[model samples]
Target: MFSRAFSNPYISKWIVQGAGIIWFLGTFGLLMYYGVGQAVAIVDALIFALFFIFGVNIIDQTFNFYVPSGRNNSMLLIFPLLFSLVASYFHFQLLRWIFDEESLYLVFLREVFLLRWAVLGMAEILVALLALAVSKLEEQKEIKNREVMMHELSREAELSQLRQQLQPHFLFNSLNSISALTISQPQKAREMVLQLSDFLRGTMEKDHQQWVSLEEELTYLKMYLDIEHVRFGHRLEVVFDVTDEVKQLRLPQLLIQPLLENAIKHGLYGITEDVRIILRAYKEQNYLMVQIENPFDPEVAAPKGTGFGLSSVGRRLFLLFGRKDLLESKAVESVFTVILKIPQHK
Candidate 1:
């Protein structure tokens, strides 16, 4: 609490000003003690302290308008020296007028004139340097804040672009399927159209959301899978093995869809037999872990297309969590597996 109080600029400014006043009072009092006696010494100290405070105030206010930089910083010393000379002259004249009859005290004041002027000059220079440092610090803080904002905006834009790109990619494929089914299977194509409409509506709603519960995301994934089921029919099969404890945990919205899409594209495409894709989710230590497994025949050449789904998902994970190790994929014994780790923040 005490440290916080002192860190406040208003509190610190007043504390410094108070200390300066006390220093002027004590120094003047000691200087006048032996020559002028206690009664006159007190009065002399008070008057000189008032004049010193006024001079300090003038220096502070001047720096508020203009502070020297680069080659001009020599003005730090020059300004104080000039202010001290002027302040000392006025103080000396006032003291002489107030104590014209005290010859001993007048001699003492003259003797100490140079010392008082030097002390005031040094104090002013110190204050000027402090002001310059504060200005530079504020500038640096503002620049850092601006850089952070720009980075956030860039990340958000890229995420939006990825979302937009995924939608059209799926839409074009669905449209092709619908075109194929128009003459042969009109009823199933119409059903797929309705499912597509619902899935696109959910996507629009989730675009403004950053995170969603695992249960909600699974429901959204079910909608997407329904549309895919219409396209591939019984050849594509998906299994979910999610634990109840992890259903309430949150992950990035639409994070799982791309992985599932990739699995189906590689697993079922060009394969006549039924292919099974498994998705498992559970909590492990401080992370919500999810794993997807699918089988592919290595002997057959995979579909020729750009691999945007996996790359975009990986980029999104890195941007959100600042970790490259969150998403991992490996192919072993013709079985392709993807493991994703989401850190749980309490």
Candidate 2:
């Protein structure tokens, strides 16, 4: 009956806060019953007040540290009983010495023993309540962790589906370029096919890894860009600024391709002006700083697509690193930028 409602930190803290009121009532109750002039009674009550606080904090840690289910409840009862017995005995002995009328010995013994039994009963109920609260918290924690795991797995599956969708779209575009080249320039058509094959080989080789070294992913992306450059000619240009120390650090595969595609498609959609894609990668303290920015065309609205590419990267970053604060996208006038910050793993 005591285990479920007040098991988590929110409820547990509330219970402890309420215990402050309980402690006040118990201390004042004992003081009024025993009389304030009885110094031993006052001191004994104070000791028990301290005991309540200590018992609560210690039991919270012990139960939550995972003492094994079978042995846990036994330890819970044993600790409070032993502590109370010793405290009650001291309380009784101190009173006996103070009164010193030997005839009252029997009466004192009689009353003290009865009081000890009552104290034990109260202690039992309190300990039961506390242990129950701790048990509930542990169960709730396990449930929350499980929920997080399931969410991450679902996101991973969605990402896989998105990658599949993208591959075909990317391939179809490149194939059209090769088809055009087959008639206009036969020699260049053969070279484009070789590059296409190499690019597909790289993509197929990475079917398992969600992440790869920056250098490795960059190499693959450059192959794809080479094919696009051949098709677009002077219409597209790419500039890469990467630090030597961070090239070997691992990052999500194809992290920059979507951003590059967004830059060219939207940044140059309406006008015949040449579009430039600049990608920057460097280390800022302990973080991997990646920025994909372009001077977007002010005259054109956004392009037509699924509208999930940038958001997919944002969501993936948040899920992978547990960083609700890291991924950011900003745009003003002619410039649109996506900033990706992930913990650098060497």
By lDDT, who's the top model here?
1
Per-residue lDDT over 1-346 for candidate 2, one digit per residue giving the tens place of the 0 to 100 score: 2224354767766676577557756865765675444554455455555556555665566555554356555655666676666656665676566545644443644476657646754665476565766567768887999998898789788778767766786777678888999999877788888988998888889878888888987888799888887787788888899989989887887766766666666666776778887889998898888888887766666777734567666666766776777777788878888787878765
> What's the number of clashes in each of the models?
0, 1
CA RMSD of all predictions: 3.0, 9.9
* Cα error of candidate 2 at position 191, Å: 3.2
TM-score of 1: 0.89
After the best TM-score superposition of candidate 2, give how far the Cα of residue 5 lies from its true spot, in angstroms.
Answer: 21
Error of 2 at 155 (Å): 3.0
What is each predicted model's overall lDDT from 0 to 1?
A: 0.83, 0.70
lDDT of 1 at 61: 68
Candidate 1 lDDT over residue span 82-117, tens digit each: 988888888889888988998988998898899878
Candidate 2 overall lDDT versus native: 0.70
For candidate 2, report its TM-score.
Answer: 0.56
Q: Point out where model 2 deviates above 4 Å.
A: 1-148, 179-182, 186-189
